[model samples]
Target chain A: MKQSVYDLTQQHRSIRQFKDEPLSKETVQKLVEAGQMASTSSYVQAYSIIGVTDPDIKQALKEVSGQQHVVDNGYLFVYVIDYYRHSLINNETKGNMETSFESAEGLLVGTIDVALAAQNVALTAEDMGLGIVYLGSLRNDVERVGEILGLPEHVFPLFGMAVGVPSDDEQGSPKQRLPFEHVFHENQYNSDKTQQLEQIKQYDKEIQDYYQKRTNGKRSESWSEQIRKMMSKKTRPDILENLNVKGFMKK
Target chain B: MKQSVYDLTQQHRSIRQFKDEPLSKETVQKLVEAGQMASTSSYVQAYSIIGVTDPDIKQALKEVSGQQHVVDNGYLFVYVIDYYRHSLINNETKGNMETSFESAEGLLVGTIDVALAAQNVALTAEDMGLGIVYLGSLRNDVERVGEILGLPEHVFPLFGMAVGVPSDDEQGSPKQRLPFEHVFHENQYNSDKTQQLEQIKQYDKEIQDYYQKRTNGKRSESWSEQIRKMMSKKTRPDILENLNVKGFMKK
Candidate 1:
């Protein structure tokens, strides 16, 4: 019997290295169709998928992402929060829809819509025996991405996905997640700092052990250590300005 | 043979009414595990799931959502963008992680993380023969929701989900999405106004037909009409202020 989606999800690992087999147009269509079917907030469907096939365009995106896989994958899909279509409707009817899409709630709705659709695409591609990695690095420079993709106002490039068959060298297992008890709250949030700190300490140990075992003790960074190293300096301080340039979060 | 995730996604329709049977604790745990396995941005699992079982809490949340399913479902899950754990780590280590999580990029990362995980849970539940509907209505009163759920700083309720076995009367088909060509651009975004407006005109007709057929000719609102009606006025004007209050997007 085929494994259930839950089982499939448990096996998920971001695949960076991939075989050079490109997906067919039919497969791309199927993936997009699956993505389109994800639940949209109020049927707004405030997102679009850009299939980057032009090698030059992919190269441009790769430069923005600073990732080889952005250009090496079988397919590259950049998901954008798109309200340009709604804008068209607004213009034709002379309506005031900008009051909505220009608000912070609009940003949340668009972001949620794009992510949900992308996850569907991710899971579906995985089920089809493809490996995928998200390219948030696309946001490393939003203006350049917008220029590369020719995205219009009210359409913000949130992230990209590189999908293809995994290479033999790509053999990473799922990373350990936060314990269910720590992430799952019953009825109300347990803001008890002591309990939360205890859970994190245990998780930190597990992460350290996993890293040590994976790298023969060459690397043994705990989760907290890694997070501190990553988050100590702001990554992409220009995001707010970029969002404004893209005509998002302007309310 | 079991259905593929793509096939499963194609059949997705937001299910509101549900059977009386609640999910088992083991099942909930399995779903949460599946959610946790979704790829997070840089291993920043910046989200928490609140499983509301207490009738009073459910009723309180239902008041915020104004949705009966919030109280009537087999289970209710409120997905929050959580940076509280990271803040704790920052406090203990006296790290400058706030420079990252306080930025707009942090908001994007947290929102994307929560939505991706939520989608995993949605698909997993559907695969298990249960139904689910997202409750973006939870944002209708974020402050009230925070009070009800006892959410703390660095944690914001983004949305909720109501899950259960589908009731016999609960039968609805997936709504037609925008045209594949319209939503999926090749190489880059084609922001040509004429092309986009033409696509939207066609989609409007399809949506009109869909509603007319579904409601036995009682309703025939076009997609454009519905969007104009829903978005002409601002929704959740306080989202930005709320984000600031919750210690998000402060920079």
Candidate 2:
């Protein structure tokens, strides 16, 4: 019997190094079909998928992402929050749909739509024996990515995915997640600071142990420590301005 | 042989009515575990899931959503973008993590994390022979939802999901999506105005036919018409303000 999706999800790890074998056209089409079937908020499929096959375009994107895998993967897909189609409809009908698609709620709806579709693509590709990694680094230069992809207004490049067969050197296991009790609330949120702090402390110890073992004691960092190091300085401070330039979150 | 995730996704349809059986604790735990395994941005598991079982709380949320399924489903999950734990870490370390979590980029990252995890749960439940519908209606009253769920600062309710076994009367078929060529661009986005408008015109007809066939010719609305009607006015004008109130996008 095939393993369940739950089991499949449990085995997920970001695959950065991949074999050179490119996915077949059929596989790419199947993955896109799977993505399209995901639930859209009010049937407003406010997203698009860009399949980059041209090496020059891949090179351009790689520069923006600063990741070799962006160019080395069997297939690269950049998912964008797209309202340009809706804008077309609005123009033809002389409608006022901008009141919704330009609002902050519009941003939330579009972002959720894109992520749901991308996850479907990710899981489906994994089931097909493909490894994948998300490229949020594409946001390193949102304007440059948009220019590279020829994205129009009301279409924002949210992230990219590099998918292919994992290489022999690509050995990775699922990272530990926050304990179920820490992330799951029953009925209402438990905002008790002491309880939360205790949970974090316990989680911190577990993460530190995991890192020490993984690196044979060469590295040991708590989750909080890693988070502090990463988040202490703002990353992509220009995101709000970029969203405005892309005709999103204007309201 | 078990169905592949690709095949499973093609069969997706938002299920509203459901049988009266609640999911077992084991199943819920399994689903949550699957959700947790989804890839997070830089290990920032910036989300929390609230399982609503109390009848009063369910009713309160139902009022905010204005959806009967909120109270009638076997399970109700409210997915929140959570940075509270990180804030706790920041407080203890006196770190400057707020510079990241309060920025627009942080909003994007947290929203992506929550949706990816939620989609995993949705697919896992469907694989287990359950029905699920996303409740973006939860955003209809964000403040009211926070009050009902007792959510704190650095935590914002993005959406909800209602899950259960499908009722005998429930018969939802997968709706037609935009043409693959329209949503999936090759190499780069095809921003040619004539081509895009033509594609939308074709999709509008297909959607019209779908609704006519599904509703026995009683209702036939084009995709653009429905979008215009639903989006001509803003849905949630206060979303930006609410996000700010919850300590997001302050930058």
Candidate 3:
């Protein structure tokens, strides 16, 4: 309790590597329960946490995520946008199944609720001095990961988290962010192109300096260039079809 | 700092009623900055927060959210799934805005990022003795809100939040959740409907009891019945069309 929640949030950093340590079932259960305490949309609780403990599953998930942290961390939990349980509740009580839990509204509610719960789990783990990194790379081949995890329709795996003791005391430093004015808008959006570009340029300079110093001058790309490089690629080209077939989002 | 993050998370309750005291711009900015500290997918940081302060806009948003808290609270913020800023970077650097920033994967990343940031803000506010209530009803009329917020393409208003000093000290106790085993699965999903049904029945009974007591015999719906009642109605039926016309979730 030495650090306030605000301080822990501000000083947060992602951990890609970790030391070899095993988390007990009870310990993991405590973290997962902490997730359940989060706010849910309409109390639907449209989410699930799969604690991957089997060695085979961990190795497969590591390959799926393209991050060794998945296999090396003290614990790895996959957060899934779940409607199956709710569907079950409907089936039992109403006896009238929903034709689609795949509406855009459902997508927002389910995805947001899952994300909120996952953040709770992450913050709690961080409070315990555990290093945590979100494994969004788990979506590199989402269908494959879903199949391996036995995820049914309407239970898409959103992301994974790797939690463990830090291999080194160096979490480095908190990354720099854009200017406060540029990010937090007042009332209507400030879509003034010139003003935003001017602010982004200044923030880009800060990012460039941070990267140049942190990476020992090996990488000196500005924020704009970084965004360009990142966005140029076609990621998960079949995303719509996957979401449609997996019953994620509909009208 | 006496309370652990776990305690703070578990004690979380929706704050609908708030004191008339106004929040300083600096305090809200600090909370927003703490949001930026959360992990982003591939550094996309695909989220934008609109601080609603204009009186007209506030009144309009309060109606849109169907929650008076939006208008009476100390602060109101709408978290938008944003890639327009990223599109701007593409325009500045690559001069060729990639067409793929509107994919389902992108939507997931953006939505999750916004939710994570929002939960940080909520937790920070709660830790500081401020009340917080997420405004999911903002989506009740997505187009109207988008117009009100002057939101551009690639920025969908996912949700809003109200934060202020608690009007009353009685925050109430946390709600009960499903058994640990029902929500937290092992390496693979347990699709055993019989076992799940048994557990859910017990949970439904507990919820029925809680609601009955809280409402003084006015309401006694079990968890299953509650979810049924919620899902029976088609909410935001035009959500897909809304998102499509507003330029979101394209391949």
True contacts kept of each: 0.93, 0.91, 0.66
Query: Which ranges of candidate 3 are over 4 A from the true structure?
Result: A93-100, A169-171, B93-97, B169-171
Per-model TM-score on C-alpha atoms: 0.99, 0.99, 0.96
What DockQ score does model 2 reach against the true complex? 0.92
As for DockQ, the candidate ahead, 2 or 3, is 2
Assess each prediction's global lDDT (C-alpha) against the native. 0.95, 0.95, 0.83
Q: What ranking of all candidate models by DockQ puts the best one first?
A: 1, 2, 3
**Candidate 2 — which residues are off by over 4 angstroms?**
none
Worst 10 residues of 1 chain B by lDDT: B171-180
1 or 2, which is superior by DockQ? Answer: 1
lDDT tens readout by residue for model 2, A63-155:
999999999999999999999989988898898899899999999999999999999999999999999999999999999999999999999
- What's the fnat for candidate 1, on a 0 to 1 scale? 0.93
Model 3 residue B181 lDDT? 80
What digit string (tens of lDDT, one per residue) describes model 3 on residues B1-251? Answer: 36888888888888888889989978998899888888888777888889988889999998887878889988998999878888887766665445567777778888999999998888888888888888999998989999999988777888899989988754577777777788888999887878878878899889999988988989989888877778877777877787777666755
- TM-score of predicted structure 1: 0.99
Instruction: Provide the TM-score of the second chain in candidate 1.
Output: 0.99
Model 1 segments beyond 4 Å from truth? Answer: none
